[model samples]
Target: MTGTDEGRLHTAVLVGPEGEHRRHRKARQKAATRIESTARDARKAQAKARRDAEQAERRNTTYLPSAGESGPAALRTPGRLRLPKHQDTSATLAGQYPFLAEGGLGSSGVFVGQDLYSGGSFVYDPWVLYQQGLITAPNVVLAGIVGSGKSSLAKSLYTRSLPFGRRVYVPGDPKGEHTAVAEAVGGKAIVLGHGLSNRLNPLDEGHRPSTVSDVEWAMQVASRRRDLIGALAETVLDRALSPLEHTAIDLALRDAVRSAEVPILPMVVDRILAPNPADDEDGRLAEDGRLVGHALRRLVAGDLQGLFDGPSTVRFDPSLPMVSLDLSRVAENSTLLSVLMTCSSAWMESALSDPNGGQRWVIYDEAWRLMAYPALLRRMDAQWRMSRHFGIANMLIFHKLSDLDNVGDQGSAMRALASSLLANAETRIVYRQEADQLGSTAAALGLTGTEQKLLPGLGTGQGLWRIKDRSFVVQHQLHPAELAAFDTTTRMTEIARKISDLDVPSGISNDQEES
Candidate 1:
């Protein structure tokens, strides 16, 4: 500043104290820049030393080329990866991939439950399956241990089908389980028993199909009546009828039909006991029918009287949504139960024979009791065989598959008839079964090892549905309303919560043994 300011002294005087402030600011920035240059020199020195060391290290190191190791130790192959294609049934392939499930019965028909394996909704309609050709038999065999929810499933199936314009018929409800369901669905329950005014004439001309001509109908009715009377007698006798007994029944039935416009069981019984002189020209006719006559007489004049001795007080309406024969009143009487079932079987036979009966559900609930009689069991086998021709679906419910063993002795005709009921049904729904029953049930239905193991672990409303050859583990869903309406344990449940010990019998189990 002394050499330069020599000529700038005059301007510095004009600049005053402000010029001195500017000079001091410039001096401070110059000092800071000097300090920064000193720090930058130190950094450059450190960088140069680092670069030299790195170059020395690089000279000592070895590396591979960009194309990778150039030797046999490269561990690389020239060929691309490949995999073989697999071919097998879905079921066999599912073993290779355990997460897979049954390609469910498609999204059509009734939504009965959820498919446990597929993680999708499960739908089942016997007729739908038949239409899809997945099953040729529209009949179903439902088996489960007592309180295993078979009853509820049966009810769900028929009730759900009502919306699709199908009808239901419970030929006999020994425990009256279907009575409420029948009533709830706007149908009639023909409740008949002792002390009740209700009566069912076995000879009542039942529903005549529109497709039948008068002559054809007459012949049909006559044949049905004759067969029904003989079947009733056989039921009461606990064995098949002889040729002579059959002849006497036919002759006596002819006499009754001629004598009364609408004949009753008593008329046939009286004619069989004391044959009309004109009809029984042979003196041996009365003796031939004595055993058969007395057996039927029990239905009209003995312990089984009052329900079928006169013209029917109730009519079997084919157009109704459902019809259930309530034999609970006489369930205690084996003879009476068989007689009622035999009579109702004829009623249903007439309805089923009609071409216009539409699609119907012929359910045999508590089938074990019905099969005890040879006549009813024979009719069941016939219905199961002819289910396709009749446009009707039949469901045979059992407490367990082993119940069929009680039908008759091994290799007996009755045993074969009972076995035929299951043989014709392709849809077998199995709920929770007892440990002892798993073997027979699995063998009878051809369940897979996994399916057999699944039975014991099934919760309520869970069932293994084997429709034809395919299988699904279904969890049946119900609406709050459907659940409340379908509940069968109301009696036991009500007896628990409200009534005091002194007012009720204490045998209530917290868990419902039957749904």
Candidate 2:
């Protein structure tokens, strides 16, 4: 072993050590990779096990009716299988008709309760029921005191209902609650007032100015009140006859107007009421003069101008998603008339003309006032008569059932009419009310004890909801903007801008135009 032999041996030892170190590194890397892959596989298996367990739990929890269960279950099965008494039949029943526990507002499709027992057990979910088309053609009646948040609840309902593409028409003078809702939903608001009318120039717009003929047609459709018509006719005869008459009188007045080629109303007055010297000897003229004179006098004085002027009277275009008739400036009765005339006419035309068959919802905030008019009564009757075919819904709001009674005998008729309307509504909402009136209105609608109990405790924006055949109460939460949108000023500038575009004539001035 010389010096060269010792160096070679040391080099061999170093090379051997290097080879062992390389083999160890490779084995460690392989082990680490195997561990990572095994960990991933374990995690996946754990997740799958958890999912399977959850599915099994759901299957076990879902309700299904037992052998002896009757009605819906019996109907579904032609033959029955006997089961032990301890088998928990109630769970099975609940599973079969989940809606029985949840109610109409629970699922998407319409749920027609099989029995009164099952129907009464239905719960309500406003959001779910509305989305499912289960509550189509809802006629919502909002009843509450002045500050009981009726308007707020109405706004919530309108906004929530708009996503379904239903045409929502709110009268112009909404207590300022629905304006924001209209805007938020991409709808239009037409503020009705003297300023709106004066600025819009409805007469020159060529939207077919409302004639006495239109008024007569509206009246004829509106009421069977012959006395009201007779009174109106006599009033027209005494002072000035606009060339319009009842359908019975249209031909005669039209012929006269055509022969003279003059606007009819003023001319009719001249012919009927201008004291005729030729008739003085007949004695018939003097005897019947008083009644005719009184009738004509009242007709001329009784705001007939609104009839002719109303069509051109500051109406919002139906093309807009929403139209608000800002009747804040108009007298209450006059406001009611204006809303009834405008909305009813627009609805009639839309129902007749629109081919796509869209549904339109007309919401009346202080609906009792419109119910007072025979014309409005007739319109509502027509709406009810035509609702299924025309896809129109009327959402009428009143403080109480008795508020409807304020309209006199007409009120009673309206109440009966309203009952029919509610029957057609499919969806009914009864919010918080005084303890006294609560029981009666609730009973009238056939609400159960549980429902009645729920009514008194309803919070703001909360109330009972009955969709189609089911009833339950819910607390509705509104978006902040929606709550604030009811501010009157939100759409004022836009409305003013629209009015400014109308070719309104400058010559006509109205005392009501002072704003």
Candidate 3:
């Protein structure tokens, strides 16, 4: 091997195929770069196309018109719907909330009227409420100003209940308004006045309960007589009888009873005025009973005479649908009225005690007058307390809620008793009242501010009923017959007529009236 040959062999060989391979490799690299560039561009274009399509779709989308846009579209076209804000108490709101109102008392009792809130019939019965445990006491306190239709509501509630086998007893009707109602319901109204033939003998054996035996009845009669005479003395004297006076009354009642089988009031009075020497162990017996005896003498000889000094001409038939003691003629005499009520209460005691006496309503109209007398007030309180036991419902009607304030002093026992009558009664029906009376009425009833406001706006026959824990605004509806029967404004509208006047049309005068 030569040096030139060795150098050539050691040096690189420049072949044409090598140059072509380098060019081919470069071309392959260029082709790969071009393919990658084209794929990247294609991807970029696809992304742009998708973005453009989305933008076009958004541009073409439709939306509801803004406020005041003109087109044939619904009136609801608006930027944002709005409404006026409303606010009310839960009590008033419960009434306004159409679906949230009370379901109402089940229709199992006497029909009252429409429940303004629930928009359903409002029916109430004491027995029904008692049976359902809605009320523990069956008594009612109805208060309203004159012309508010409280009387009619009371009349309707009781009269409508007559068909359900309940009887009514108005122990003292000062206005005689219940006289017609009593007669209309096939009941009796014992109208006792100075000149009337109706007499109420305080000493007569009143209605006897079937549960009472003969000896027991005699003892009860004796005890009732003694208590009645004592009460009479207290009422006439306007003070409680002392112990000696009570002893004297006992002796007189015993002697009177021993002498006559059915002794009258005069005999008891005579015996008290002149006690027998044998019974008067103390010479001061007559002197101790002098004032009491003379006080009781008023019923037999004084201003209160002729009413209780004789036998009971009219009987207290418990089976009657209604019985009212009409004291309208004596309403002007408060003491006399109280005396009559005392005797009447004693007379009613026997029938009320009857186990089979069934359900009854004892109404006390012009209750403010009755509450003034301690004896009568006590009697009423007892009846009210025993209302459930006797199966009776006592109704107290007053001209206004403030009448309770006049019952006695602010915190006196009489006042407490009177207020208790209201407290024990679960059903309190209040009608329209004067604005000035709202505070007292609201305070007495524990009414809310809204209820207090509602009172002044209540229309005729509209009432607010607070039953137990519930409250109701009721629009009392009356039939035409009831309206005519309960009309108290006849004197305001009725024209005076002569007996000799011929039948004529109402709108006709001497010329038009004669027609």
Candidate 4:
């Protein structure tokens, strides 16, 4: 340490060559630069190889087609997923993905059944909903295929509502499906047909309201009688009445009213067919009324006589819990069906317009049949429009929404009326429909793609309910008693079951078996 330190100190003291020190520093810097350059080139080579391999793999890769793979492999092949598993409470998870299901319509109204989406009980009441400001209209339109249990749903809705002090009035039941139900619910079913002793006078002064004066009622009765006579004529004629025909009907109805406190259709037909000279004024009045008189004559003395010819055997009691006109016997005759439904609707209209009628359900079963006539369809449209004012809910049932197409010619008044019925109905309950029916059904209902898809897949008693802007998929539950009362498949499927239950053997009557 002594010798070396001494030599170094002597060299430093001597101020060794400054050019030598500079050379040493420059050499060290050059060596370090060479090492860094070699390392950079090596890295570039490795990166190039990696990029080439990636490009080659991309070119060789095959992707699934838009229509997916063919054969059994179709849509089954996919890239492996590597997402990390997640764990969280449902409430916290809702923060990320919310509104998975509806909160529900609250715990009011009638208990309908189960809500498919919310996994809870569903409830619906048009009146309740209207009162709550959720809907403005109380009318409902129900469409479903035959045997789809739509009838059951309708029965359930109305019957369950009876306890709430609501009344039901089925103006025309073509199949008589509601007869048993009406009787079971302590209501009345007026069965009228060709052979039945029951009779109906469309001119019967229906229940009078205390709000109207005697003079006002008189005017209303006159106006109603005149309209009824004209409507009956048009229904039988299958066309609107001419101005001359209207005059004929008015004169005939006035004459009938003068003759009796409550005149029958026969008297009106007679007066129109043979107008009194003093009233005719013009000789052509008889001729002008001939066609209309004959058209109405059918209801009194012709083929359509048995039901409306004589004084009404059964009265229209608006105070009853329910009143359904059973037209099953007359359903086979189109003209009879139209005429009877027209009369029945007029009968119901008076009670419906009564301010004291309270809340009621006016059901038009097999509406397609009733809608065939222009006058009847118009009347239905009027009733639907006035439902809110009268505090009544009108439910129009259809085998399918396409039945509306059969009402009238395209763009005709009847068609517009049919469309309006759908528009006024804020609640639309659709049960199972055929594949072909989905398009028009969806179009008429304003259903989403999801709701439309739900139509064909619905089970029995299941319906997609669109109440105003809200949607609910409900599974309607039925009591065994209701099931028995609402069973329409009796003719098609229950005969064998009934037979098997008999203690007697097949083909053996009870008397014969006992003998």
Model 2: lDDT of residue 404? 50
Off by over 4 Å in 2: 1-100, 103-137, 161-163, 171-188, 193-249, 252-316, 332-353, 404-407, 410-415, 487-515
Q: lDDT of each structure?
A: 0.89, 0.53, 0.87, 0.89
Please write out the lDDT profile of model 1 over residues 393-489, one tens digit for every residue. 9999898999999989999998999888888999999999999999999998998888899999999989999988888889898888788888988
Winner by TM-score between candidate 4 and candidate 1 = 1
TM-scores for the candidates? 0.79, 0.54, 0.80, 0.79
Stretches off by above 4 angstroms in model 1 are: 1-99, 499-515
TM-score of 1: 0.79
Candidate 3: tens digits of C-alpha lDDT, residues 292-327: 888888888887888877877888888899999999
lDDT of 1 at 304: 79
lDDT of 2 at 277: 42
lDDT of 4 at 258: 86
Lowest lDDT sum, 10 consecutive residues, model 1, at 506-515
Instruction: Give per-residue CA lDDT, model 2, range 23-97, as digits (tens).
Output: 899999999999999999999999999999999999889565555556775566665578877656563556775
Clashing pairs in 3: 508-512, 508-513, 509-512, 509-513
